[model samples]
Target: MPIDRLADLADAATAPRLVVKVGSSLLVGPGGTVRGEWLDSLVRELAQARARGQEVIVVSSGAIALGAARLGLAKGGRGSLADAQAAAAVGQIALASLWAERLAAHDIPAAQLLVTLEDLEDRRRYLNAAATLARLLKAGAIPVINENDSVATAEIRFGDNDRLAARVAQAASAHAIVLLSDVDGLYDRDPKDPAAQRLARVEGVTDEVHAMATGASSSGMGSGGMTSKLQAAEIAERAGIALAIVNGTHTAPLARGLSGEGIGTLFLPRRRDGARKAWLGGRQRMHGVLVVDPGCAAALGRGGSLLATGITAVEGDFGRGDPVAVRDGDGRTLAQGLAEYTAAEIERIKGRRSEEIEALLGYAPRAAVIHRDQLVLL
Candidate 1:
């Protein structure tokens, strides 16, 4: 498609749900103080979008900035992870308060939602968070989300809000994601070089674009660089959401980008599956593996539920409710499912009948190894 047609589709996307991510550089000044005026303006624009009957969610990054300023930490200091976590603990509260106050001016209520990677990893928690955000949007409330840095361990950290924003966009079934950062848009080369030029549009994250992405800037406040931004774009694009990377320095750049004013680099959306299928496609990790016989593989290929009789082996330690990969005898993953039995139980009852399960294990909760509803054919 032509760039103009793509821009027109993005403009039409304004009527649907949108996720806007603002980086730390946009929300803080050089002195590490919160830019209340800039935040207020951003909130006003978001409110305007809401007034147009669009649902807007903001994934903001400035907790550490606010916290460092409050704690009088010197910039570029080599602080321990514990110290940084402390700063986040302090800043997150202040950051939420600042946003709440700014949003109040527009007569819009903003709710703060802090989440860790674990929240998205756990199936129940993931669905709960999605439902809560949906309800808040339906009630005309702006949901402001941030990483729960205060208590998030290294293993569970989201690292940057860019990726988190893409996850939020997928969870909300957003039509578009606007990522506002210090740089205006992606460049063919380092924008610092005189010969470098901006790429106004991208259909996908091609190999050429991947080669052009450099590391993080020397700026101490922000964690994510252009490379992380591209990774986030890839996530949103795969889920079939248009993504825009614009300069946060430009006031109301998000609104302008959505209006097809050509202020940022736009990523065209791909054909999408429904939201649940998209979520399944992007699952980050699987818990265990279920190796099946040829018959079971053929059954799954024909959209059939896995049965215990066809099970040849089970590998890895996993709980009954955890998600696991279903593989064929040669060790190729054929599907993913929520296992009805634990790995140990599967070992004891492999190739057993429902009647035999009770004789061997005292009881049988289910006949199928994994019911059809719990299985996703790959």
Candidate 2:
């Protein structure tokens, strides 16, 4: 793809979804101040993209930096884990408020989601988070996601938001991710060296590529450097999401980069399995079983969702969002999917109409026992 065609990667007709990652250096200024003017420019670009029919999700980093500043911690200092956590606890609120205020200026509602690595590791929690993001996008609100730094221990945290942004792209089923950074893009050698050259595009994040990455961040506010950005590219590639690294220190950086102004490095996706189907197909365990009738089996074969009306029996103690096997009356597994309701809930609604679900479950009913989008055939 030519540098001039970069914008097409985010075209609504072609991609439809995008994830933009704003690092701490871009969002927060010296002494914990929010970079209001810069943020307003970025927010306008986001709003324009949204108006063009793109569903955008933002993964922002600034909580720890803001928190540390509030606590009067020295800049660039590696404080104790407790200090970092306490700082994150206080800074998260300020960070969220900044985003909310800026985005609101464009009449774009912002919803904040704080997550730790564990949230993505757990199947149920992952599904729930993904579902919430999907619903938020559908409702025309942009979700502003950040790591749950306040509670995340060193061992349980992402430490940086680059890789976290890639995971968010996967969860949100985004087509491409734009990483707004201090540097323009990847370079052949030290960017400071006169002989160094910038690479316009990266084919893949191979060993040689990893070797070129520098581990330390020049800006103390952000933990991510080129190394973490490369790791994030690798994650996005495997998930079939394109990743772009570009300089965002200037006004309208996103608009310039996406406009194909020859400003960054674009990493193409090697696959197209960036949805829940891939994860569902690769799961090693099925927590429960749903025995459906012949009619339901036929319906599933035609790509229809599993409805309570077709369920003859439910087995195991699977909770909502747990992966389960869909079986027939003779006990042959027909497919596998995440349950919309728990085993007990399905048991109570088996062979019942969709309309009768509210009466049985004592709540507003879901349309399917297992939605087709969440199901995968064996």
- Misplaced by over 4 Å in model 1 are 1-14, 74-78, 285-378
Tell me the spans in candidate 2 whose CA falls farther than 4 Å from its real position: 1-5, 76-78, 273-378
Enumerate residue pairs that collide in model 1: none
Residue-level lDDT of model 2, residues 1-378, one tens digit each, is 322245765578766898999998888887778788898899898898898899999999888888888888865224777777788889889988988988898899999999997787566787898899999999999999999988887666777889889888888878789999888889987788898888888886777988878988877678899999998887787677788998989888887777746588888755555366755643435789999999999999998999999999888998998889999999887788889998999999999998899988899998799999988765
lDDT of 1 by residue, 54-163 (tens): 78899998888888888887662117677678888988888899889888888999999999987876767878889999999898889999999888877887788888
lDDT of 2: 0.83
Worst 10 residues of 2 by lDDT: 1-10
* True-structure lDDT of candidate 1: 0.78
Deviation from native of the Cα of residue 84 in model 2, angstroms: 1.2
> Highest lDDT among the candidates is held by which one?
2
| Candidate 1 residue-wise lDDT at 136 | 93
Q: In terms of TM-score, how similar is model 2 to the real structure? A: 0.72
